[model samples]
Target: MASEYVLRIPLDRHVITTQRSLAAVLEDIRRVLHDSAPRSALQGHLVAAGHQVRLIIDRPEATDELVRCLPDAGAYCPATVLVQAAGDGACLAYDSVASAISPYQDEEALAVAELFDAEVLSLLRRVAEPAPGESGQ
Candidate 1:
């Protein structure tokens, strides 16, 4: 059985800025995921260096749906994105899809959750990529 985990992707610069806003990146993610900018169940925080967004995706393969089917599914509803200041850069972090599906040992559910993991990681990595013409290390 898989266990809970987190995936953190570092960015070349601060994403939570008016120039390269985290909001914009989040909106982009929503479009890619749902084709609409769904409301975030929770938004913004002072504890983090920059900002954070939390939203529940109630898709057929999401945590909410999984819980409805399998009661043992953990409290994975509402995925999260944290933009934390990293020196002059930033980091985009989130809980792995496996983290939410791990509590349920159902092999079928695990396979579906793995798909979510790949999609989420791809979106985050795309968001963290440096813009065109921008230097990256």
Candidate 2:
């Protein structure tokens, strides 16, 4: 079954300074995924009003493996991600899930969500890192 993962990366100070814009960061992620997992169908676009980028990754194995490699790929900013699997329901922000209605089905779903969060955060940090000899301004 195909699992849909939505990555919502905000254009914060770190992102703005490193990536310059949401489009740039999204493009970087697209390139990374393309190079790392050629078979995974990756689709991404910017949500201008929110000043963030949303990346949709299809396929379960591809999503799991590709996301794991992202942290090592390059620098970027960390953001919330939503993972939705058919029949498995959806996993949202943990802190907000309590006050807001949740679709979380089980612990396994939460584990996957956490994994995505960590990997994505690492990926963003890598993306935000300064190049060669340039100072991270």
Q: TM-scores of all models?
A: 0.56, 0.39
Lowest lDDT 10-residue stretch of candidate 1: 40-49
lDDT of 2: 0.37
Candidate 2, 73-125: lDDT as tens digits: 11221233332122222111112111111133334433544454445555555
Estimate every model's Cα lDDT from 0 to 1: 0.51, 0.37
lDDT of 1 by residue, 1-137 (tens): 88996644332221232233455555555656654333422222223333545444434435555566655554554445565434455456666656556555677666756666566566667756666875432
Q: Largest TM-score belongs to which candidate?
A: 1
Model 2, residue 7: C-alpha shift (Å): 21
